[model samples]
Target: MADFKELSRLLEEILEQGPAGCGCAVARNGEILFEEYHGVKDLESGEPITADSVYRQYSTTKVAVCTGAMMLLERGKFLLNDPIYEYFPEWKDTMVAQPEEDGSYRVRPAKRPILIRDCFSMAMGIGYGGTDYTHQAAEKVRAQLRANVGEYTLQQEIKAMAEVPVAFDPGTHWLYGFGHELVAGLIEVVSGKGVGQFLKEELFEPLDMKNTGYHYFGDIRERMVTTYLLKEDGSREASPYFQRDELFEPEAKYEGGGAGLFSTVRDYLALTQMLACGGEYQGRKIMGRKTIDLMRCNQLNEQQLKEFRNPYLEGYGYGCGVRTLMDPSAGVNSSVGEFGWTGMLGSYVSIDPAEKLSLVYMHNLFPNREAYIHPRIRNIVYGVL
Candidate 1:
């Protein structure tokens, strides 16, 4: 058995310092070594956070949608190198933006077609939300998507994203963008089912991850945690996003793959446990062990990994929507084969195949990169063992 007293003390240190609340768990060889929650779920009501408290997973939702797509890959439903245009024809004419010395960018034909692997690896030149001139194109596309959130289907939104000029040529440079959103749409197209339905049938049901979903509703609404923003004064303020009535509704207005989904620490542990167990949980095979190996493998080369941005991804290799540790020194006391990603709201998970260990730490703080929860928790987790 693993003693997590040090880990608990570390979580308490941060909880008292700033964050409104936190939830953490660790599992080894299908056994939970440590699981604990602290602080309040709602500041106003002073509701306590329990294992069942639901959280908006943000980008951490990528692993779930990617896992769904990887199942299709294991079934031989599609080849990774297959051009996405084969499914969404609108992207066949996709263009890339090339920067000039004058601080201007010119649109040109893509060097090559975007492939399914590009989407999974985030090498397709997809981008995230930004407000500067450099990100104007992606932001416009995102704004359009946000404006029509509930109106368009997943496929429709993907097509809209295609209309935006790509940041770079496919496979040239790596950018942590909305590839998972495209993957979510791809899953729907390949599986002949809605994204939510496919996940329910393929993953949530089998793993018994009942509380995980693209949307919140019913009695689960009451269990949803309040979102918070760390203020300049070192205090936290509740984000208005979670205070809305529709936020806790039964269905989502938009099923964004890049950053969507609300889940509990327990449910997410099941998902991680499946990956840690090489795509199986409790005798149920969610995906092939070989396929899981491919997901953990480094998918980028020297040049691509060099260009991979995002401070948290330092010393890691991009692979199928997850970050694989390419060098232990580049990460926080990690094994060379560990892989995982974090959410924008401070939720993070890591699976170390070398050690057969899985860790999940959850919280509700924005500007997650600045929060430093991921590295702190990771260091403590590794320090204990």
Candidate 2:
């Protein structure tokens, strides 16, 4: 067992110096080493955060959704190179890339078809932010989708997605937005079930992740943390998008694959543990070892990895999740080959296969203060080990 006192101390200093709420958990080789929580869930109500507290996982949900998709892949339901249009006819030869101005450069048909591997590589032609021509075109399509369809449902949203122009040819460059959600939709189409239903049957049930799902309900609402956003003055405000009681409701406004799902630290740890164990947990084989191997291996080439690099991610590659490609020599103390991702609300999970280690941090505060906390937490834990 590893001593996590240093990890706890770092987390404490982070809370004292930064925000007022935080939670963290550390697990290794399928066993939890330590878990901690600090501060209030609701400042006004004085509700304290605990191990069971659930928070919106944002993009962290991508890993779960991707894992679920991989299970289907292992079962031989679909091949990685299979054209995405085969699953959804509407996607067939439907992608068109908008080009730079001047009649010489204009929109063109995709050279290759969108495939399952493209989704994993985030090269499926969708992005959240940019001012480039492709990004501008994608944004316009998103706007049109929202305008035509008032909600982001699977059927409705996918129809709208089909209408959007491709930002690049399939399997070309990486862009992160809506690709995972589209994967969820495709799962629904292929499995003849809803995304939530498929996950429940294929993942949550097998892993005994009782509190993990697309939406919380009934008594689970009591343990749900209120989402927050950072105000201009550095104060936190409740997010307008997530109401205090929305978790209890059965009908959700949208099935957001990219930025949805609420889970407790322990629940998410179970999912990550499964990955660390090469897709088996508690004697059940959720996915074959080979499939898990594919997920952890670098899916992007050096050039593609360079294109997706951002300030937040230095030497990294897109594995099933964010993967550190280089050692922490330049900065970032995490081990090379570490793979994981963070949520918009300060939640994070990372798996160091080399060390047989995993770390999970869950929080509800926004304008995420991860930069201040992640390094300290890594240093403390790595130092002890």
Candidate 3:
């Protein structure tokens, strides 16, 4: 049992410090045990955060995207050990990016090929596509996206990834980058459908997640909460929603698998609940129980785990695409096999399989203060449970 009153008070404190508004929900055994919204969706108009309010999921989108990919794996559509080159031949001879002392970078032929499993585990050395030579290559794709808009297709940009040298050899060290984007590309190729369309058909539709997708639908955009930037002084300024994040494009290819999803607390709960229930929603099996187990198993070695260090992820291991709890004291509510991911904008999704419990916490704040906020929410949720 949970003390809903205490939970509400704690969430109120969250709005006092971070995002202008937020929404959260928790479910156990397919029943929502706790659900609530706090603060205003927009500070100016005073629009309230509601169950239907949509949010840009950012990297949190990986959970659902990975689930869809794992579905294909469960069906034997692809094998984890298969090299990515098998699907994208351009990746056949990828190179490594080695930074020189002179502040420049050089390329070295990769020691091994990127396997499908590497993408799932973030061991493909893809740097979130922003800083390094390889990331710059990814940035070039986005630059083109900004310039030409719809002209730069997801496949075209993903294929162009081969031209960039990876930060490290695939399967060597874990680097959080565009590996999942590549996974999304793989999903597209394997399904013979666009990534967005494939998820709509395979996961969203089956779960009746009508409010979740990569773009605006019906009133989704209209119902979105305002994004806020939290200043060092602990004040929040309402910023434009979704524009800086490049979200809510109705006709977008949504190439980034690690980010670019729009969903609500209720809509995404459908996903976490299904995962918590071992891939079953209602009576239908979205995926095999064993596959879900495999997805939560720790996939990193001792050295790779070092590269995955962060405050919020202290006690977790990188599995499939979610953080698998290895040591509960590291920061989980209270389960060994708990797993899920976070969006860049302060949102978190946690699924604890032992108790068939899951939680979705949503807020849109820049410099999300994930280290301070996420653990508090996790503790409260688990403490009450």
Best-performing candidate as measured by TM-score: 3
Candidate 3 per-residue lDDT over residues 1-385, each given as its tens digit = 6577778887898777788888889899899989999888888899888887888788898998999999999888899999999999999998998889999988899999999999999998777656668777767766766687555666877776677778888898998877898889999999999888999999999999999887777988788777888888988777775435454676654456888788899988989999999888888988888899999999999999998977768888989999999997654657898999899887899998888999999988898878877777778888887
CA shift at 268, candidate 3, in angstroms? 1.0
- 1-385 per-residue lDDT for model 1 (tens digits): 2247877887888876566788999887799989999998988899889998988888888989988899998888888999999988999987887778998888889989999999999888866756534368766766777787645666767877777778888877777787788899889888998888899898998988888887665668788888887777777888876434353355545676787678889898888988988777887878887887888788887888887745777778878889888876665588887898888788899988777788998887766543366787777777767
| Residue 193 local lDDT, model 1 | 89
In model 2, pairs of residues that clash are: none
- Tell me the spans in candidate 1 whose CA falls farther than 4 Å from its real position: 131-135, 138-150, 242-248, 309-311, 369-371
Model 2 Cα shift for residue 296 (angstroms): 1.3
lDDT of 1: 0.81
Question: Which order, best to worst by lDDT?
Answer: 3, 1, 2
lDDT of each: 0.81, 0.74, 0.85
Every model's TM-score: 0.92, 0.89, 0.94
Identify the superior model by TM-score, candidate 2 or candidate 3.
3
lDDT winner among the candidates?
3
Clashes of 1: 0
List, residue by residue over 137-208, the lDDT tens digit for candidate 2.
Answer: 566766777787654567667765676667888777777776787788777877888888888898988999
Supply candidate 1's per-residue lDDT for 51: 92
In candidate 3, residue 202 scores what lDDT? 95
